[model samples]
Target: MRLDLPCLGVFFLSVIPVNASIRERLSYQGLFGCVHSGLLDHTGCHHFLRTDSGMEKTKSLIARIQFGKFFAILQSYANKDHFNYVQFSNQAVKMNQDFLEIKRLVESIPEHDDLASELSFPSHMFQLMAHSATFLKDTSNDKSRGHLSVYHLIDLSVRILALHNVRGVLDSTNSISEEKIISLHRELRELVSTFVHDGDSESIMNWMFQDLAIQAEQDLQKLWQQVSVHGIACLSKTDQQKCIQLP
Candidate 1:
């Protein structure tokens, strides 16, 4: 029943195209059909397709979530300061709100639309918020380990924000250029390097960092192969090696 993180990561990467296809196939009628068969009703379908306002609301919410004061709190916590429980909790609540809004917006879109590619499930962000909430409750009496958990939470939040920003850019343009992909890889590398440290060796945090870096590298490689003019010509030899380097 327990799934390995690395395997789950690979599974996620492998399913991107399939998930995109499935999302593209979604339609109001299809949703209504699901309702008609006792799955959902007219009211539920309407809620699902709140498309007109949902998309704009989702974008606004995401922008606020990504560029808000929440990240400042995360930065403080990441720097080994005492964990601000109130601030962290407030931000987690905001993240949950963003997640729900995104889910609703994605549901509202018609099937086979290019806009669907712009929205991802925000699975990592959801998991990060859930875990942070649980850690807050469970470690109320253990401030020492709580700091470590907070560090992990901060890293997760940064990763989520980076992904959201990248997806927003890709979605707006509806196409990925070689330069854009290269920029994405560079941004990912910089983000990963920001928190990864030698002192984290043998810790769960270290493992998580490694897993994220490896998965990112693999994803970039796959994406490069998918869209590169000559399947790696876009990258210099040094960059190519960097793309495959593990944490």
Candidate 2:
């Protein structure tokens, strides 16, 4: 592609073959380092990653960047506005399922108990919330509690880890907005906050857990009144009730 570097516009290069992948010319290093950082603009690094990387490559890069930015947003800022209750609750369920699987795989090791305990919350969140909430209700689909395919399990594991990094920020920062942090846990159905209480009390965790019921009420809004929202209430309703349970 022959074009002006100083005046970089969205215009395409006529010299390059129309079918060529843009990754042929674009470099992640140049994009990451030389591109003026976007922190000054609320858009941040999103625009820097945009390019004509052909249809497939562009789609792949967009997905990766979306998840990357999503993680970064959660890590750097607790955003209650982006929280989806159904999605978060389902993830909580899936996380439980994943913990069980991980335990099964590590059963022989002596430290497995410790690791399994450490993993429980993350795993429950994985099983219930990781599948697209829109796609999860079908009950017959591959991702439903009944089916729980391997792909679903693997994908949930990855997302829980990404979200874990996001929540891990709570352990380090003093400036995270209390309302925002509380909103996140509430949106996740107040399940994550359980782990926050198990050890030395973190000021941040305590703050996040406080006012949780109020946050959940606000976060759940009208859905709280709906009678049909029964299947996933109060975390572990399935396991405790002896309903259709995942092994």
Candidate 3:
């Protein structure tokens, strides 16, 4: 049987893993760093931090530069008033260089703890957000050229991360406009909605708990609504009208 949003929420919300404050025990950076904590048990990060491989760091930097080049070409045809998904698909590649840089950065552990922590956020974000491809993109199908796909969201996420310093709505940036922010939020919901039509219940459920809502950090919009806390009021037909007062 197919589970809709409300059923999925109810089915999983109560069972939402508790005990360790994922927020406290596993911070975004901590999780990604293989803190024994998470970001896949914090294993992969050690190599990146400890490696003497200047070659790896050089590769990551080159990937970032390449992304900026591609993105600049994309921006030229953005057509702000109305998004051009076709033009975008024409440009958006399945595997982005931005993600490649992120992956490379995470793999090479630097000597300084502070530096590793600093790179943690983007690396962590990449870990959490990179899989939109599984549910959001289908290379064999015409899905990539569809209205929305993994390529679009990854590009958007990377751009916002760059423009906003990975702060999303938390920090202010003169470079990105109010319209851009609004559009980004809308795109997030649109991407999320697509999840319903794509992946199976188990996989989607895992992502919700592990990445999107994971306390282990790298959650794109931690500062956004506490859907878990407010699900009751939001769902209650009688109570839905009132404001949700967080305790």
Q: Which stretches of candidate 3 lie over 4 Å from their true place?
A: 1-112, 124-138, 141-186, 196-218, 223-247
C-alpha TM-score for every candidate: 0.46, 0.24, 0.31
Mind giving the per-residue lDDT tens digits that candidate 3 earns over 1-247?
1222231222122222234354432332232233222234334555534543333222223223333344444455443544444444434442243444445545454444333333434434444443443433334255434333334454455454443322322323233333444344444444444443345654433343234323322232442343323321233423322323234
Candidate RMSDs in Å, in order, are 12.4, 20.2, 16.2
* Top lDDT hit: 1
> Which candidate number would show the highest TM-score if scored against the true structure?
1
- Over 114-223, each residue of candidate 2 has an lDDT whose tens digit, in order, gives 33333334333333334434233443343333233222322333443443333322222233322333333343443433323436464322332334323333433333
Question: Number of clashes in every candidate structure?
Answer: 2, 20, 9
TM-score, prediction 3: 0.31
Ranking by TM-score: 1, 3, 2
lDDT of 3: 0.37
Q: What is the lDDT of residue 173 in candidate 1?
A: 24
Q: Model 2 — which ten-residue stretch has the worst lDDT?
A: 7-16
